[model samples]
Target: MRQMRMSHDEPLLAIDGLKTHFFTREGTVRAVDGVSLTVPRGKTVCVVGESGCGKSVTARSVLGLVDEPGRIIDGRIAWQPGAGEPVDLTTLDPKGERMRRIRGGEISMVFQEPMASLSPMYTIGDQLIETIRLHLPLGKEEARDRAVEQLRRVGIPRPEERLDAYSFQLSGGMCQRVMIAIALAADPALLIADEPTTALDVTTQARIIDLLRDLQAETGMSVLFITHDLGVVAEIADEVVVMYLGTVVERGGVDEIFHDPKHPYTNALLGSIPRMGAGAGRRLATIRGNVPHPSDRPAGCPFHPRCDAAIGGVCDVSDPPHIVFGEARSVRCVLHDDGAAVGGDFRVDGERA
Candidate 1:
């Protein structure tokens, strides 16, 4: 594997003002709007949000995988390859050689649906070996050996025997493991796991999370994990980013997010999680409404309508100011504006007051 020359202070990936939109007959859908975050070297950053909050789209945007009608209209994705100066991924042609090489070779992704991602037409071995050869200069036999090693590394049983098995032949958890094996075949510096454990059973999900953590420790790869499960975030996230309606609502350390959430949306989400040892008849808490459709987004603060602490005239009329507490901690909310609630001067530019 290649050594990363990046220093401890520099982040492995930095995204700034990313805006991905889909132009359709009905209207333009802003899937990811002005989203900014960073993934530190060899650490897990979990992007947590409800469905339709653009978590998957944001992950896809990083890999240049957004499909037709959907285009990355604005942004800068600075990728530090640990050698030369950082490369701006947003400028590369999606289908060009450099982007293609970087997509699976440098930054691999384990897609949401393992079965849908793996092809039933080919044996798992064929898929894995193909991926290995695409990025690594290895003979067919060597690639096959590497594929088996990857499967074994991911905890698949009877690695050699399973290599010839088709995606439909394996269980959901097993297929997910295979997808992970393919993703890791080239030893990518960064792994984008888009809800990889969502379709698995509780036990399987835990195992997958453990496997990823262990692999990260072994390979020193950064993980950008996208999920709605705060439980999973608590398990693996070094930093947590909360998204709402295509924009980041809050971001901070995992402990800070869970213990001292600032944004009303973040507080509501934490409240909605089922707690243990509650009274027998106690009802679970829930957020009031569904995420608004992108095309029908509300005016001003996107979350104002659902936020309980919203300043009616202010939040509904103007965009919430971005308030920064310190490096790596920020919230976008009118309540946090200076003298309003938290007593911090809010900046429209997301700078510290």
Candidate 2:
């Protein structure tokens, strides 16, 4: 067998052509169709898209959390654990022992709804201790102490007291903090946070983002953050992947995606971000049309229907290739096709192309 070498350039997680589909009674719902991205070690990679764009499904698929009727049908999820071999996560059984060890031990996730994630029956301390003990070879007392420390690490006030409290006792922000604490209890190398700030207030959201950053800095762990909010992406992301429908439309560094978005969908998303000093009466830019249903997804370029830069008989007729722009940026659009104009800024007024 060939040995897997861990180089500095190797990504902590590399997903390629991932197709997570749900076989419903009506038809197959291609929730995450051929989505690919990478989370480098010690860096934050944010996947941004509107609702129903398969952002959550992609995150769930990463941890083998996709429920029944849905399964990862294709591609490989290469997960590099330290200097050891890179394991293919997609090939593992969802409920099998190896995956169990990998899920919470190698990679942990903080979900969107903290209240729902935490059990109402169990006290926070019990839950945290259980998770810690499950992943680590710690006795009950040691796990309990570690749980308290993890709570403190996440900035939960009076960590020892809060540990014994139920999930209902904590506010929304505090509940989220506890979720992060649980995720960190194992000291996983990769942390997958799925909209951890969606329901939080602005200040609380900022705090949560900062907390994650601090934790990453302390642990040197990579993060795969899934959110629709570009503001949060801008605040924390080192790399950004823009998903539309079920595929990655564009992906680049944070500044590249924000300043020079090539895909129409990406450009529209960047324009939609609210500015601080906008005119009082100006309306925020909005992307027109809704995300197409999985069953009713359009042929060829999935985004061509609403894309202003879409060329007639071209974009709707054939799928565009992944246009590579140097090493850090890649876009999926017809405007960047061979012999097509691939320079300058992308305007949404139907005039750029």
Candidate with best TM-score: 2
Against the true structure, what is each candidate's TM-score? 0.94, 0.95
Clashing pairs in 2: none
Candidate 1: tens digits of C-alpha lDDT, residues 1-353: 12234454679899989999999999999999999999998999999999999999999999889998999999888899685667888888889999999988999999889999999999999999999999999999999999999999999989999999999999999999999999999899999999999999999999999999999999999999999999999999999999999999999999999898888888888888898899799999888888999999999999988876666678888888899999999999877776555335533322335
User: What's the number of clashes in each of the models?
Assistant: 0, 0
lDDT of each: 0.91, 0.89
Model 1 is weakest, by summed lDDT over 10 consecutive residues, at 342-351
| Residue range 1-353, candidate 2, lDDT tens digits | 22345565699998889999999999999999999999998999999998999999999998899999999999888888767678888888889999999988989999999999999898999999999999999999999889989999999989999988999988999999999998988899999999999999999999999999999999999999999998888889999999988999999999998888788898888778888999899999887888999878998899888876777777788888889997769998877676654454546445663
- Give the local distance difference test score of model 1: 0.91
Prediction 2 global C-alpha lDDT: 0.89
Model 1 steric clash pairs: none
**Could you say which candidate leads in lDDT?**
1
